[model samples]
Target chain A: SVFNVPFTEKSSPGSTPALSDSSLQSDDEEFESVDALEIYDLISSISDPEHPLTLGQLAVVNLEDIQLDDSGNPNEIAEVIIKITPTITHCSLATLIGLGIRVRLERCLPPRYRIIIKVKEKTHQSENQVNKQLNDKERVSAACENDQLLKVISQMLSSCK
Target chain B: MSLSLVHTFTGHTDKCWATSIHSKLPLLATVSGDRTCRVYNLETKRLIVVLDDDSHSKTLSSVEWKPTGEFPSLAIGSFDSTISIWGNEEAVLEDEDNWTLMAIIEGHENEIKGVSWSHDGVYLASCSRDKSIWIWEADDNNEEFECVFVVQEHSQDVKHVTWHQHENVLASSSYDDTVKLFKQDDYDEDDWVNVADLTGHEGTVWSSDFEKKGERVTRLSSSSDDGTIRIWKILHAADDQPSIDSKLPSTIKTDTNQDMWELETILPIIHHGPIYSVAWGENGYIASVGSDGRIVVYKELNSKEWQIIISQPHSHGVYEINNIKWHGDRLITAGDDGLVKLWELAL
Candidate 1:
């Protein structure tokens, strides 16, 4: 029933600057460091499959939840950990959202950056299962290889800048 | 039908946004989000040169080669809101690495989306997120480009700019869900006017190209976020009548009739997601690549109907395909996977 209705702007408290507007900001001149805001910018604008609102507007991706662990050496590999919160406890598309975030980071970031996408603790009903599915190398690759699933994920990310 | 991978160019560090091939040479140039432009030789499957100097600091979006020039010249558009012209002076030189920056045109306030050179290589049209399309004239004697027209008629960001195959006309697609046609004023040689605006797509129009069917019939193909490829047929009017509403200034109206373009047909949904790029191939094949990582080729069965002849799903894995262009029989595609793949139709 929710899918049939067109979502008009009903302001919520979590509404911030839209991801489309913030992502268009020029990158920092300093290329040596990877900022956490950049990671937030990448995933915040992803449209939800159930709702027309962005992840940022739904409070699914917050700047505070993105953590970047660098070795302080530019040549060494860096690790990025993103903790995502689903809008509902029983949201079925959590894994799909996580996959979308993972794919976006993989395309935008360099090879040296290791990405870890996880469901925020207690945010979903099947948090452990969703986390395992999101982080499993073979499972992630297999989901990406699926043409039908990839189409849905692509639609979720189509609104991203 | 099936397709085979010919070659894969793994030079760009990030997503390759646009690609263009030289008219007379075995060269293909591609721009990437890595802020670099790479030119590769199709014959040897080797990279000729990489243009990643200090000139471009942001992502390079589009690149186009001059159709007819004394020497090989390229126009590159970047996210830094500027377009750089690179030229090779020594045409006969064996060295392919002698590319020098000729001019830098800085006018747009935001990212430059697309740059295209006219068929005769006289005019260069570029669109930008600033909702404007600027036309530059090439002064061969001075080796410089002068800004001639800046048309800010689009209500939203202009995504792509393409020139007609046989005329000086230019077509631009925008995020406003419309495609506009512009041509030089018949009465005044110095004035460029917006002749028509096509508004059938319900979502953003990403790319468009002209296909010259015969002597008088010219067709236009456009890909949009609505997940459909639309074909429009261009008809020349015998009398002075505007087919669509004229957004042009009243002073630019002349007594002669202008060309009329009507929506011809809508192709079936080949890709489930948004289609980003559509290119009319040289050998009567239409190739399209989209966000679903699939490249689908369509061919006309009879005089009226078009059908998908070849469908290559997962051509670039899971990443979105940014651009697809046909160089002779081979189809060159670049995408967010950071790989430039060449595909040939399998017999």
Candidate 2:
């Protein structure tokens, strides 16, 4: 565990990027598309594991680090990639932070969305290792099945807007 | 091939984790998040006993039946970071507490993910989130269990471990995106070594099962987060061809088994999400379940080919099936819906 860092939720999601892209939907794009800002909005409110501050307020999660790829096809595989920069370079809790984001999206999003959480490069001491564990479906699911881990994750999401 | 719903046993208050069938009895044992291991009679399709212990503070993640025992014995793994060996030690097996907690094995620092008894029943292997697999040597009485060997070869958390039907080989799937095989050395009998790492999966390997009745050229069916089921085969070192062991080993074993398991083929992809479990039926079919809420069965067309003969969506009524096992011709599945279903395959 590292020193607790305090940061609270954004009053509203990053509406600038999503609102500026006022492009109209295509004929086949009937389903509401989930964009980067929306994905960020979904997880940005998650509070830090040791602090009261939300990931958005702590600047651990940024809109630019979110990416979504949807072909607008219902049956196709839709992917959501999120990269979070740790406040400290050698943060040991990076994996837990990433897992919190992954669990949040997995619970809120549809089954088609393949969520991938990674530590932003150069921000974490072991970025690749944390990324591997966070993205593993079996590990992620097993962690969610864990009562203690789930309690912490739920606490992180308790203050979400 | 088709699976007709033969029977459904619904009693667990929460999601079911894993189920195991007794080799010598008409019984099925399933563990669930409710922190209980339930045993049901397959012949009568009735709830026989609900085994519960006060020591289990969390979900029971896995249940396994010892292949041979005087009385029925079960190895139950849990998220409480302990593996409890349960059995009826009384001379007369007649009481409300049909099962008694024999021993609580605790060594892993994290939750135990899977527990499996070897084909011979002398060895019980358990994999855990601590990234280590522990093999405990037990007796026929099930009263004593000694942690004999520990293999820490997997780079990440180990999900599941299963033994070969009649061999000493043990295959373990892991969150490290690989399946590793371990065996006791032919020369160094006390030492358990990682025989091979079957890599090629781009995502986490969830579970792997060894094909039953295949003695010489053994086969392994592995399910993974990559949404692919792969078949791996290996002959005895004496029978394997010269082309084996072609994949270079990063850490060479100075003295180990010379045999090597090579990738045979990948099953036709059917499920839309991560496959959580795979089982090679004693009836010679490969059955699989996954997070997609689908049950797919495959038949061997030949040595090099496999065909999807049965594909059923929403088998558990909107819940993901976590574990599936084959009992002779019948298929048994445990789902997140807290239901254990028995299906008859109409070939």
Candidate 3:
């Protein structure tokens, strides 16, 4: 079950919490607030490259794993941190999956929002390497430039609704 | 054995959203994020007119030419929640400055995403971010338009609306990850109802176009955010069967009572990114463009399967292609690079 966490309540860093009912209700007036559920809804449907199921269905992205830091001022920049769990301990496509999630959120979310995508610690053997690649701006841009890799990444995201 | 770039029309200062070519005239109309619509002469490759004014305060998303009207006209959809119709004055003697604003249709609450004229040019369909598709009918005598129907079945943003080549049938693709078919009611002149909801795409459907084989709309092609292009065939039920006659035009309505459309083929992983546009060319070809900046053309081989005939990677040099149109035997494409490129099939 997805953990129901309130947006107003502060949780420990890197904690995963399912969005609460209040957060979901605030989505209707999305222009004023950036909720944690909105970020979950964006990346949860992304299809795993090896499986037909989504990242959310495979338990790669849980509601409790999404954290949002919205400055009190709506005009200020907001931060969304998503800690993903690989389907397997040594899943090779974790970085691609993270890139797919990053691309989707970048296209859909407002520019004022900053995104941080990383693999959960101790979830995979190459957690540090994958996290560094995903968060590295130059590495992400270079990876996106590779035609063959982009094709595979696009296929992984094709299942997103 | 490769398609060659024939010409490139560079004028738009912002990302070009859509392109529409005139059926008879050597003209093309393009709309852009710069809040302007440009008309170009294909033969001379010159900008004939620029339809930019303070009236359009937001980006223009789509443009379509009236196929069978008395005078040449263009329908433009903008982000300002309005659709504007421009008509060329027949009585005017000048070549330039003849286009005038015929009407401003304001029904959509949000940005208008697409606008298309029926093959007969008697009706126009517009879809919007408001999750509604509005059908407008023109009154020939008064030159005014009336809203015939408003379809709110799509649960999310409606991205594109297209009409069949030979019938009054309309197809709409939406962010709801579904494509819907709407046909006019036989008994009620003003009524249009949804007949089918195609829901195979796992992502938002970006665009859809019907294939005109001879005089029939035998197939439909849809491009989606899933980076795939799908083909669906229309099937008519047997006369003896009890069919769901949701609504079909009277011209093709037989005793069968029902018509259904089934997914025929899936061109999976055709692009490296989300496909934004797809068009069925008159020369028995299909072209698709996507976020990967590639324009790929396909042709059916032996009526069984489709094969990629031309694959132009980096057609816009890393710029996402938003729309494409078939002008005569040539193809015109617009993209985020603010340039329009034309390609011709290699004979």
Candidate 4:
């Protein structure tokens, strides 16, 4: 079971609280200002590592559940579930794709969010583990606001530009 | 959202092996195992011309653009032991209706595997299974062409040849597991000579290319049957001419057997497939396809390490990838599977 917690009331950085419905609706309007659909569209801008098309166009990113926290009546946490596919089932580029997704998600999502990446339709060995590593790193880094990811992304964009 | 398949060209009965897109023009040229070369117009989705005959005895192996020009030209080589040049003369005509056959190059005794046109489109270099490479220059009349020189150095069949993107140099790879560089110098009678012979691959070197990444520096990429792709950095000679052998008598006017060029190797082995095709990509990345049907993306890391940025496998083994044509941000690849695929890497 998932619940949306309102961000209106500030808690200590390290504290974890239970999720409820009545409290989340109060702060929901401000958070909904940035629609969940809009966030999904933003993440879809991520491209395929080998092809010249977006992950959305290639149908590589599949979004399933959009869960929220309700403890604060309106300030709820957004939990998005996603699945990824490579150009080929046995592609060694799965890691790169996962990293690319993680990077793009961090760039588009709000602060202190949890994004779950589930691997589907991959029969190749170790694909799930590699995808998990990529998402886990991003989730932890985003929660901690790791400076390395910022530096890496900035450098990459500068070079590509 | 749903992705729809665009128009499919069904003219080639056999597998398509090579494709070259005129960067500044809307023309696309394809060579196929059917032993024919066809030119197509992208805007009209129509077949413009077909150039094939008894001369192309076997499969057409490669095709390349003659740089960029208003009346652009094309060069095609085939396994039938011939290289043919095709172009249009619209610049000098009122009605520029069709592409015409410009010249037929018949010199290589064995299968002519690849052809490359110099930067100015004034010269062409062709390599073949006959273990020789030939250099041809456009005639002063501009309507005809002739063989000016030949380099017979590779011990095995020469598989691919590519002109330096920004210089008067050519690079060739062979079945002997080596890559050789050729350049024309004015000092000695023989204008063409071998400069570098890069040796490292344990299997056949199937394809090679020279891409410019920085000022006067080129990245040399080679795909081999040994299941690996390799990269090398070449520092062009400052004089802009190959070093002529002082030992060779200056009086000798035309000795085609002269060996006078020099080459140095940089970087290390990078891919894990029998690389069949390699092309330059935006932002210093080099894209390569191998026999494993995998498109391996590689980027240079401080001149020593080349990171495998991506390894995308096609559904089947890709026997030959003759060309990788870049159309703006998109890259189109044609393989042995008879399918042309487009790819873009996510940042």
Candidate 5:
């Protein structure tokens, strides 16, 4: 059952960094509206960091929805949900991919955005690590407003570029 | 299905998953769930390298030698979602005989299933349960490896990815019951195009091997959960370049591309259960093992008579035989029973 659940706030995958407050915007509704295929195309551009192939071509992107908050004002925040698979289920690459996804999303999407990238499971107990990874990225993305955090995310992205 | 243990190295106290043999070096590299990878000398039955000091917390799934020249470098994958490259032979000679960590590749969302070095050893390919494939290229001796491409094309857990022995192409199989082939021209950018998608197996395809014929001709043999072994040919009899639009269309293509490529299935021989492993043996013989606990040997006779050499039920109820590799003239079979059995044909 632990595997079926998506991203969680805790798991021992080297403490995931939290996002800084500057980039923090109003939380969007649980569901967001973004094209799954388009998001897939963007994230898939991030290489495996280990292999020379694209994650999209390798079939690792598990997508849900990208939507906006419907609270007091619907245009306040944008949200996206995505699931990523490592080449191997036990791989340490999840954290990097998660971080890469957050940086890519923040760079590609509009401002005042809230992206929730969860790790979906294909087998029992597989999503636990993915959730931890996503949580770690969320914390870092939250910290993205910081000059230093933005620099790290930018360096990470530029290294791939 | 009765598994007869041929060899069992009981040194490691954890689960062993990754295994590879160096073409020139007389050694074997194996990674374990114990967060350590052990190197062994088969001739002396002695421990060569104990890659444990700097290992992962969880299990390691795959390990391989760089496909280039004879170097003591190794590429390992783990549950921590990282691929660690080590070239500690020189460092070992200087100090503690340690295998220095060359690079740690951080990507993938789940555990990695397989890692392979290209024939030229210029690149590394890894697959994960996240249903994706990652290809990394080594720049030089001093620089760390970088991610060149990420292929997310499978619909389920990708179990294994194998490189074609002589070509720049790579093949991957997954729980989604499809095997994809990819080729990159000159390794220019992050884009590695998907050239073909071979289908037909109803269950998961576990393992595949590329058979070398002369210079240009090659054959791909795959084992599947559907309890069958199928062979697909990569070269045609006509010419170097055939019809461009004859093959299956690229799976990643948008509606803009009208050209397609085709891969005709040459033979689909049935076994008894899920075929977990496949290998190419002597004299055009293709061998496969499955959950049926049987090792079926099939050979193509004059392009017509595909005969079964032997279907020895080696394990009980298709014991979890994970892989079968050919070492010289003998066949080495490994399974969940923790046994590595060797078999020879009694001609």
Candidate 6:
């Protein structure tokens, strides 16, 4: 069961987290570096897997929780780490929600970005387990290949800008 | 040991997922996100034909060749939740449209990850993200497949399904971080039951394969996301005197009977990331591919230890290899680079 509790009122998808479309740039053009705010926009509009609300509206994905390290190093691997908080500690849909956010970022970000998603510390009852399951690359890839789970994730991403 | 690139089969515009080598012929079939299965002849080192259809709307995940056919028959699993069986019974000599769809098996609620045919090609087993493994009974006519059993034992999404090379045992790896083996129950013989649960891997088990035929009992090789390869050996009471081997842990036992399978050894870790596929070649070698874009081959030093004979980094360039197969003495690999490569191993 989903606990059915709304944490906050709805938020708009038009936050200032969006960056330009990188595909249009030619080889000579400089690459636009990604920031935490832009990463937030990619997932803020994602619909919650449990409730009929955007993650932004529910305050599940805050801009402060998103961390990006795309500093100007051509050889260095960039990183994006996001921490999400469940409405309740015992929520059963925590892992599914985490997976949804990871999928959205994977589709939008460049391959150079290493994504690390986890439940906020001390929020979930089984915080360590949830964090471990969310960040495992093998399990993440296999979960994305699942048909039923993909459908649910697609629904969550449909509202994204 | 040394390795040399022997052949490269190219044409896929998108990532290729898996490849299947013909049992009797020198033909290789590869499935790709381009929605086509390309068959390449090893002798000519060229693609023979591309089997594509407008009916397929999603990427094909896995492919397998039926063992006994004079003309090759392929079983392809797709992301669109359908398994299409294609046969070349009436194929001409190098025609573009040589293969035709024979049957479409649909029942899984979601995408099919892996598919396998029994050693004799009598049974077809498929695992899906829906967390179910369905066993279908197939015949030689390339028609009507009946679903015999469906079981949901894995707690999470299933990754790969494989059959024993010499027996009827079916093994599946999953996102649940464990490998479960299934076999027909003796009381019914028609119903499939979970016989054993291999519980030691701390992360997801990506792929598993059986040694062609062991000296005493069949051994299984399982590769995992934890970046390690484990070998499982079946400890039969009849094979060893005094009920069991003194070295094996007494806790090993399948759910049904005294047939216990224990983790025999963990191969040397050469992969820094998740291992996607593992294939036990008939040449007494075990080959593995992983996310780090490395292909490592291992040989048994004894039952308790294995040595890395060949560790070739960047076998598929910068792309992760999805599947690996052994064609006699050579190795075939499909990768995210939209290429299928053949390599010769120097033993």
Backbone Cα, N, C clashes tallied per candidate:
0, 0, 8, 36, 88, 1
Q: Is the docking of candidate 6 incorrect, acceptable, medium or high quality?
A: incorrect
Q: Better model by TM-score, 2 or 6?
A: 2
Instruction: For candidate 4, give the lDDT of residue A79.
Output: 47
TM-score of chain A of 2: 0.78
Which stretches of candidate 5 lie above 4 Å from their native place? A1-161, B1-7, B88-98, B186-190, B235-271, B315-319
lDDT of 6 by residue, A1-161 (tens): 11011101111111111222333222103334677887888889999887889998998889999988776453334667899988889988889989988877765654335678888889999997898788765456557655678788778878987
Segments of candidate 3 deviating more than 4 angstroms: A1-161, B91-94, B237-258
TM-score, chain B, each candidate: 0.93, 0.92, 0.92, 0.81, 0.82, 0.92
> Once superposed on the true structure, which residue ranges of model 2 sit more than 4 Å away at CA?
A1-42, A49-53, A57-93, A102-128, A135-138, A141-155, B89-96, B238-256
DockQ values of all predictions: 0.04, 0.07, 0.03, 0.01, 0.02, 0.08
TM-score, candidate 4, is: 0.58
Tens digits of lDDT, candidate 2, B94-179: 34366778888889988889999988899999999899999999978777788888898988889999988788888999988899
Task: State candidate 5's DockQ.
Answer: 0.02
Task: List per-candidate RMSD values in Å.
Answer: 14.2, 8.6, 15.1, 19.8, 17.0, 7.6
lDDT: worst 10-residue window of model 5 chain A: A8-17
Fnat of all models, as shown: 0.00, 0.00, 0.00, 0.00, 0.00, 0.00
lDDT of 3 by residue, B221-306 (tens): 99987789999887752322334443665565553434577888876356865788999987878889977677888888755588
Q: Which ranges in model 1 have alpha carbons more than 4 Å from their true place?
A: A1-161, B92-94, B215-217, B237-258
Q: Candidate 5 residues B1-347, lDDT tens each?
A: 22234445444433345467666666667665456777766556467667776656556767887756434778888766788887754523223365677778888887777888877787889988777899888865624677788998888778788887777678898777888877774346567877677788877788888775655436678777676667776544222334662463756323322213344444446565467778886456777765445676676775545777676764322133556666565566554333345566555
**Residues B49-166 of candidate 6: C-alpha lDDT, one tens digit per residue:** 8888765667788899888655778899987778999888763525557678899999987778889998888889998878999999887877989998998999887889998876
| lDDT scores in order | 0.78, 0.79, 0.76, 0.60, 0.61, 0.78
Candidate 4 - CAPRI tier? incorrect
In candidate 3, residue B306 scores what lDDT? Answer: 88
Interface RMSD of each: 16.3, 11.7, 17.7, 25.4, 20.1, 11.4
Query: Ten-residue segment with the worst summed lDDT in candidate 3 chain A?
Result: A1-10
Off by over 4 Å in 4: A1-161, B1-10, B42-46, B53-55, B68-70, B91-97, B140-142, B188-190, B214-217, B235-273, B315-322
- The local lDDT score (0 to 100) that residue A76 gets in candidate 1 is 47
